[model samples]
Target: MSIVLSDQDKSTLRAAAYGAVSLMAAATGSPQKAATNAAIALRSATGLVGHVLAANAKDIELKGKTVAELADRVLPALTAAMKLLGEQAPAEAGNFHGTILLAIEAAQIHPDKANAIAAEMARKITAALDAGVAPAAAAAGPDRPELQKAIEEIVDSGFVGVSLRVHDERGEWVGSAGTAELGGAAKPPTNGHHRIGSNTKTFTATLVLQLVAEGRFGLDDPVVKHLPEFGLDERITVRMLLQHTSGVFNFTGEVYEDGTIAPGIPIPYGTTGQEWLDNRFKTYRPQELVELALAKPARFEPGTGWSYSNTNYVLARLLIEKVTGCSYAEEMQRLILGPLGLSGTVVPDASPELPEPHAHAYYRHGDTTVDVTRQNPSWTSTGGDMISTTQDLHTFISALLGGKLLPAPLLTEMCTPHPTGIPNMDYGLGVFVVTTDGGGTVISHNGAAVGHAALMYSTPDGRKTLTAALNCVDDANLTIGAAFQNAQQRLVNEVFGGGQADPA
Candidate 1:
């Protein structure tokens, strides 16, 4: 009595299920609509089943039957198919329910076969609902163990919380570990919001380059021409700013070879926890951040050497504002966010709350580490004030690589490398050009501030992308820092054809 669905039947079932669920969800606006849509969906699914059964019966080929005869014969065959399938119990009733619903609504064939499929699908669906299991949950894909392990390792690596989303040949995988907030048991939402750190630099560079595409500015144009207040060396150009060759002093304090820390404005490092926590809500202007760095000596002469400087991007932010006569955030929205439909991403001005269903991020400071999870991000400004989910990050990177954002030639120039004195890696415009031993190149950027870090990576063609947000239990020993880098490499290699490095 058991029915064994052929591969074609299985494929049809999957397609039908998806169609049914989508139609039901979309057409359900009110109680009346829901009822009407549900009925329509069920009828459509039933008709599809009838069509499939009728087609199967005619394929027997031993007797050359006319269309009417085939149709007549199909009723009994469909009844048998349904009885046999019912005895076997549909392995994925949730999937079948959806497919059947759609077939019923759209079916233009035999009504009897449709009714049988609809009845069985309804029975199974009701049973599932009565058991308090969502139909969607029952049809969910299998869990990814490898991705789950990676998330757990990140949580163990001293982050207050961590969440990751990865996409590969296997499709999208998302997972999270650790509490959303300090001393809380709730796990972070894998797609929750977090500070994107220096990843903002990539966006800033993209905007600048977009304007460049429009002839508003030239890459080689001197930075001083755009923003005369920086007192920048004439050798520094817009290209240098994006490439981090401007040699601007890092405003968030610098560490020399001898480990001398020349402090800039007060940040979360080695400070009283409460002071930073209190000021977390304060807003910082891009000019203010740049001015603080300008107050200090240049890390090296502009265009002479390379050093990572938040001040450089802050200057770029100012340039964008000055040229567009709109806030950097607004420009970002108009050019990127709005166009890409990245609704979960934001350029938070002084906002502390992440968009709903977000993970909590925490900062650690003082001899006894304290949780500063809910501080204002204004201090980071254009340097690292953006908030985004993995989905948005993936969408942005994918679009950029897929040529939705920049022209091909400009994107090529943006990804071109400048020597950073680091082997195997070079700094591209606002991104890192990481070359793997496999002779493959990945464009990526990793950023950290206080407690949160964002990692973004994409292949040259942008067909593949990897994006993650990590919130660790940051400490003096840098326990989380080391582990985070390893995790990043592991994921990159796993998704992009590489291997893990020494964990030490």
Candidate 2:
């Protein structure tokens, strides 16, 4: 999932980063204070990007100019500007271009200079990104145009960015499209981390099943037996919770059969946009969240019908915590992440941070868009707040299917689907049994939290897999839902030959 950069690439990126900082400062009329501030910001961005590229995507090149070498070679004024500005730059930040863009967007750069800066950026991209990937390249499997066109179509449909990685019999292939940050030319970092949303269910589900495999508890065990404090109906078994047949009220809100949504906890927010945004930083205990859902009327009798509920997994988190006597984050590391070597994933129990090298996500506010990249994710809790990259996702799902993470029977139980929640789609314990266009099944799950989302899928044997991350302009009205759905299908069909099967 990551590209290993050589020494030369590091120097290229560092020098390019410094020049980018100087360029923005120069545009602002070389004010002494502005120069110093830009320096601090620029170094932070560059350093972050440097470590990211080295760790994740080695294929990302600065494009066209080799970036800022010209600025460094000919411009003594660049050095003079920095000297005039004192050195106080942070060691690192999220991404190279985005850090600079954030600086320029907030600074007093002249319109002309800003355009020049934009032009410079417009030409900047990770190398080989703009051209067609030849089928014969043979590095990560044969380059499939069907796959390439799927992502291109997704970007054309208006999602801001996508990073996809696949593993098939031929080999592996990775590609990305759209922009890493809005108004910038670079593609999303192919291995950049982003929120994995409800796909966290699969991970949590896997953890619980692992516990079952360890004989810690039975799948059919009553929830009341483990954490009797919630007073959950005795009929609601552990299996029902993972399968989403528990009929519990969704804490974040839910949509019903009549096309009416009963709002719960102002969540995933069924209310005004700004109010949800305002509460993003607030933290709630898992019990608080579960109790809030419990206080809401049950959607249906437990195990009687099906509806997707975020509350199920929060309770699952508590279940894991209760049984293990440690935090879910700690158990996740010990059980799956460390064993599978998924370096790009994080449990992020209430932390709002996305590790370095991530696309900026945007939330639409009326006619304008607001950056929604960082917010306390306790609202997402165990259901949807986990962060990960395409590579780590690929590794996790592949290992899970390959029987590296659980006993064969449990993994089988994990993938077996029951009809529920949505039409034509069937729910497995934590994964989805999506019957594809080819009448073949692909084990899969996908999740979205506000402006960022992830897609994951694999064949029954795990020999083939597709894992992807997308950043986009999102809204309370689900502005991009239709197009986003279309994009997911296109990619799914191209990669997995999806037919009747759809991503969950």
Q: Which candidate number would show the highest TM-score if scored against the true structure?
A: 2
Could you tell me how far off, in angstroms, the CA of residue 375 lies in candidate 2 after the best superposition? 1.4
Best by lDDT, which number?
Answer: 2
TM per candidate: 0.71, 0.73
- State the lDDT of candidate 1 residue by residue for 147-262, as single tens digits: 66766776775666777666555444555678877788987755566778878888889999999998888999998897887787888899988888888888877778788888
C-alpha RMSD of each candidate structure in angstroms:
12.0, 11.4
Tens digit of per-residue lDDT, candidate 2, span 323-357: 88999999998898756545557888887887656
Instruction: Give the Cα error of residue 493 in candidate 2, in Å.
Output: 1.0
Clashing pairs in 2: 2-56, 3-56, 3-58, 40-89, 61-126, 140-172, 197-384, 436-499, 437-498, 437-499
- TM-score quality measure for candidate 1: 0.71
Clashes of each: 24, 10
The CA lDDT at 363 in model 1 is: 51
